[model samples]
Target: MSAFLDQLQQYIERHALFKSNDQLLLAVSGGLDSVVMAQGLQLLGYKFGIAHCNFNLRGEESKADEKFVRQLALSFQVPFFLKQFETSQLAQESKVSIQMAARDLRYAWLEEIRFQHGYAFVAAAHHQNDLVETVLLNLVRGTGLAGFHGILPKQGNVVRPLLFATREQAEDFAKDYILRWREDTSNASNKYARNLVRNKVIPILKTLNPSLENTMKSTAEKVALAEKVLARQVEEAKSKWVTEGQGFVKIDIQGLQSITNALYFLHAILQEFGFSWSVSKKVMESGSGISGKIFYSSTHRLLKDRENWIIDYREVAKFVPVSILPTTQTVRLLFGKVLNLKLLEGGLELVTILKSKSSVLLDYDKLVFPLTLRSWQEGDTFIPFGMEGEKKISDFLIDAKYSLFEKERIVVLQSGQEIVAIIGCRSGQRYSVGQATKRILVAELVFIG
Candidate 1:
């Protein structure tokens, strides 16, 4: 048995990555680490095939890489699958960086091939040194426990057999086997952030401790264990403070704030929803940010409304202010909400103006036709009827104790340039219907469709 094979067996068993009978799709980029992995897998006699993705950024080097991997596949006596991609075009189309485009394309294509060819797992060549670089990059970017864990040995159908092995060890293994591999010139360039970390930052840190990779790997394993314990605790907290629906989650802030580790609980919860640390901290420190205060993740939006933190999938709604006319009794609105209008012959109690936040009664003479129903704007000033002075709409919401999120969704019914009502919230005191008023215009906001 080969020395590399011994380590491979131990690594596989230690992680329970795969059994000997499982067919693996080895993603070989013709790079040293991948080539070494392919050779090691072959040496171990695992039923596997080679898959290569040629992301055409390096011109001839890209073509040569494909050729090298194809030949290596022949040498290994395994099935070969080759895919070519216009990486630059993909990056532009996907609106991601070139490296990110290549990564997404290759992985997606590899998985496609794996299922198509009936391979049990996709064996990737990410190793210990790469793991260290990932960990350092995450730390630099300020990640939580998940980032500290770096790369896992087994993730879904993907298995990294070389994760426990170092680059030097892979190079040594290749030398021992006299394996030929193609080198990617892009890896040497510090143009990419990961390359900068790998080339300049990791090298500098290596001087402080040559065993940095092993040390980080050890720490990562320890952190992974701690993360599980933390996750268990967070899940327990979730049961207490959080509730999930079909497309959204609601966190009871009142319950969350009572927890001693509220910050940690918030971090864990927000992280699960993809909110960054900066955004999460801001939300927590906001002292219950106004209703309609929205923080976005790539996939989700977290909103703060009074005592609850609501996380829901983001719907890209284009809010084009709807025109409300005297003839228009009802109109559909965004977010499954509706706005309604009514006209009454007689005036109601003037006290109702202060009582009902949902309906506002304004003297019909004070309001103009063709009202603009729209969300709030900056510098919008409104006089809550009977107030001595005009107040900034923002300050009024704060005074009313509306969350940032609620404030965002607050609709303003404008008569000409003046705010007649913060629809469903407060009507301008200036436009209040008095006892002498003969006609009343009721601007009613219907919350849902």
Candidate 2:
């Protein structure tokens, strides 16, 4: 057995990447590194199959690469999976770079194939140099401690068995075993950021320390260990400071402020919600500032309240004004909720139903047909069920102590020009059932997952 095979087997065992009996779907791009990994796995007698993605970026070259990988899989007498992607088109549609789109497309397809074929893990040929480049990239782009650790050995169902070896080692192993593999010309172009790091940056750095990859690997292992310890502490802190409720996450500002490097901790907590480290820093700095200030991410919004920082998912689509006709029995809200309308006899029976906040009983005759259900706008006013005087929706929300996130979600049911009810909250006095009321319009809000 070759030294490379022995080392690969040892690394896989040490990491417990997968059991010997476990089937692996190897992502073989027909490049030197991936081809070398496939050879090593085959020599070690591992239960594995080959998967290749033809990201249609390089025309004939891409097809040639796919054909080579297919032949290699056949030579090994293993199951082969091939996928073609309109990578350029996908990048434009996703509004991301070509590399990122290709990566997403390949991984998603790999995982899909893995699950369908009962593969235990999807193996990728990311060696020590790739790990080193990733860490450097993270540092260049500004990353947290987790980023310092670089690529993980086993993330989800993907495994990197070759992380123990450098690019030089993989090349040497391939040459020693008389292996032939296709060379991606694009890799030598240095047009991509990764290629720039590989060709220009690392070579310059290698002048100072020839064993830079080994050194970085050691450093990453240390950082990964430290991250595990910090993760435990973060979870503990989260339990004490973070309160996750239905539709919102509340973090105790005082508790966050008391922690050392509160911004780091805040970033750790808020990163999952798509909040950037800079935004996390701003949130931490706004601790002593006035409440109701909001910070937004692509997927979520962070509100700085008096004693807490609240986070909630941002609704992407604007709420279209939904018309609820008098004859309409049910209407679905913008979110996954149902507004069920029923005409009931206005009597003392409604007195018991009125106690439930989810349902409101209003006089049918008082409301205009085709009542509009829309998000509350600024300067919108309505009279509370028991009050004769009008109140601004903003003032109503404040008096009710609704959080900024809750206020954002509040929708009002409008009849003509007046807000007949703040859906799932208060009804207008003019629309309330009275002694003279003959029919009641029962509007019940139904919550659904």
Candidate 3:
């Protein structure tokens, strides 16, 4: 008992995770690790509340676990919060693995509750055994050094109090304290990859060397330190290679060539532009080709132009112009660009239609009569969605990061003098749609050099 207490005290003192007045949100699963963690914090007299997630995967067994945890919290006279997860549905919707989905939902909910309830930190029960397992998994899966670094003791507002303890130590403490905990049957089955490692690989490894956990933990610590140095170098390389543009980042091909790890540097820059790591690699590789190349990520696309790679936000660029019903004189904005009005089949793309799928295509049929094209003026306003009233077009333009010259050059496609779509800005929120409308204008931007 003294050994357990001594180790727990040493872990807390080494990490400096909490102060006397700190409020921690302890993640309790009614498992051995979590039970030991809660007891350790209690013994230390740290102020904390217990939180549990019931994923509803094991039917009665899941509820029983929750009940046990709730009663345990009551025994300690601590505040208990419980949440149910739609694990399968969430996994499908998020397009992530079940394990990843559960993790995201768990931490997101925990942080949300923490912020709302004034908790200083969130505590989890990940320990040395888990870290070793994670490192092994990452190595087997061909992951980078960061992935091999495994679980961190402190990450932002989340703290892992059991990081220094081995699974054997935790089990011993639980048994000595007579701590009752629920065991998930899935943990024993080899159906899951983690279970295969925990049950088969780790046991065989333990037989070979009982101190395998300690050795793996030491290796993970060394890898984490090396990764930190590599990360700092990558950050410095990124600053040299990337240039900030309006709503975009430009990568200098020359500067990128100077980077020590070009692939890593590209990954860092592309993430800043909201591109995926794979797409970023493709963009970087495409830099060698003579022709321009494009690769799409979830929210954006990387365009490798001659000497620069432009990461364009595809979502933001999906806007089409509305057709003008009655052709009006072209309005020449500050730039050489002119907004010409012409009759078409449908209302403008931005003004009339919004779609979840498809690019910025306009319906050219439903344009109203007397369309006017003009630049946005000061005090100009339009109705934007989810607002009580109209908003100034200039303010909207500023929010959208339009330069002075660009704002002056913005051509508004107006239907009968009522703004249908502020060309490339937003359709006047009020002039957009009605259920009765049959035809719509097809608006297209024509860039004249």
RMSD of 1: 7.2
- Model 2's lDDT to the true fold? 0.90
Q: What tens-digit string does per-residue lDDT give for candidate 1 at 128-180? A: 99899899888998778889999999899999999889999888888887888
RMSD of each: 7.2, 2.9, 12.8
TM-scores of the models, in the order given: 0.70, 0.88, 0.71
What is candidate 3's lDDT per residue for 71-127, written digit by digit as tens? 999999999999999898899998988888888989999998899999999999999
Model 1: lDDT to the true structure:
0.84
The residue-by-residue lDDT of candidate 2 on 24-139, one tens digit each, is 99999999999999999888889899999999888889889999999999999999999999899999999999999999999999999999999999999999999989999999
Residue-level lDDT for 6 in candidate 2: 86
- lDDT for model 3 comes to 0.73
Candidate 3's TM-score reads 0.71
| lDDT for each candidate structure | 0.84, 0.90, 0.73
